[model samples]
Target: MHNACLFLGAGCNAIHRMSTLARPACLGLLACLLAAPGCYKVPVTGRAAVNMVSDEAVIKVSQEAFADFKKRYPVTRNRAYDQRVQRIGERLAKVAFWDVPAAEWEFVVLEAPDQINAFAMAGGKVGVFTGLFKIVHNDDQLASVLAHEIAHVAAKHVNERLSQAMAIQGGGLIVSGVMSTTGAGALTSNAVLEAYGLSTGIGATGFDRKKEKEADHIGLIYMARAGYNPEEAPKVIENLEQANAGRAMPPALLSTHPSYPERILQMIDLMPKALEIYRQSSQKQAPQLVK
Candidate 1:
């Protein structure tokens, strides 16, 4: 009986060692399969992002979320207001699309009037609140907001945040299951969603300061290229500061994004380069008609 027990114990140890050695190899294989080709690169910054989710996947998930968002919030039906947003959005999107093709762009103005807020989701979904519209005031201001949001998309900021979250959270069978079933969008768990201020009815959370600064810098260029006044970028920050005064600070700019004061200063510094782009675009004449 003692001899038989010793043999069985040895067999179990051998199996355990084999399993331990195989685990990492299996994980490496899975990672390779999951990894996607690098297609999208951030303009100006030249950072590369993995194109894990296809344009079709982004659009599919965004449309789903957008439909659900509309059901919860009222959409602005004013023809004049909608037309103005569309005009500015189209011009900005044209510049943005130059970097990211297959963008199924659509802009909607939501009739919410609590405080200034705006968001852009994957698949080119953009939402602007009426409260924000009041702050935007004119075409230049509106372009500033649109350009910033477009920068977020162009940089794939959302996906980057999601990837970071997954890394912190442990990878295992559950993550694999979620990825297979839901695509990259599912990686944005509720915690991340709230953090990014993507949730409705909840005061939106802000992003880290670095991301905010990056967005601001890239946004200025996008607006300038699209024929909007880049000088208006700093003005938009000033307006937001005034709009948020007295109201509970939405979130620390540094906490959710770079502090407003610092961002304003940076914009002021970048104004010259942005202005140069604007000037060049303006001086270029429309194509001459054939004689």
Candidate 2:
């Protein structure tokens, strides 16, 4: 006599009435069904993932959100910041297109000197805050930031996230609900924006730990391939730590990204391979000042 749930056939009473032992079995069945047809490999790292969301749908939402962001934030007036971001972003884009073939790459610097953040959306829209320049001293360091954001897009982590949300929330219909709205609902417009690593409507949530680490790995390789010194990759993390030394926040376990120390160690472990790519790259260029 229980009514069906929002999307699934079985209703609230039925779900609520299920025996504790039965709930696990039901969830397991749902997981199997979601996984059966959505298996795919992450770009660059080749890690397996189950993503049921479509690229077209995710990109559609992303483009709309990016347009909205432009309207809300004033673009930077600093010619130097704009030029440096564009220069390095374009260079990274050239090397990144193999993974994100549909990218309509656009790099922007938004005038937010108090916010040290940068993000890349699914459709290749990227924005960096002016405060980031405080941490990024050189073009190579900036590339580490840009490349990491780009890696998030090229790896389709947004789609992967939406897919995970849909799977956990019961059905694919959740995506429609999330994408159909224009305002501040947890799963509405904020879903895509949050997935892209922006701390919008909601407080301060970024990508999950795994996705953040993967972006770091992929970004290190990307910057090195694009002829930026990968050694500077870890320096960016160091700068961030020093900058935030007095700020109060959650512990590493509760944070979206790995601890800065862990990130530096990982980059060090990844350095030899990244260095090899850098040594062989024909596109090597001298580091340019960002400030």
Ten contiguous residues with the weakest lDDT in model 1: 282-291
What lDDT does model 1 reach? 0.66
lDDT of 2 by residue, 103-177 (tens): 999998998989888999988999899999999999999999999999999887877666555544554422333
Model 1 off-target regions past 4 Å? 1-40, 48-58, 171-196, 200-206, 250-254, 282-291
lDDT of 1 by residue, 50-129 (tens): 33333444456556766777676788887777787898899889888877686788899888888478888777888888
Q: Give all TM-scores, in the order shown.
A: 0.74, 0.83
RMSD of 1: 10.3
Error of 2 at 242 (Å): 0.9
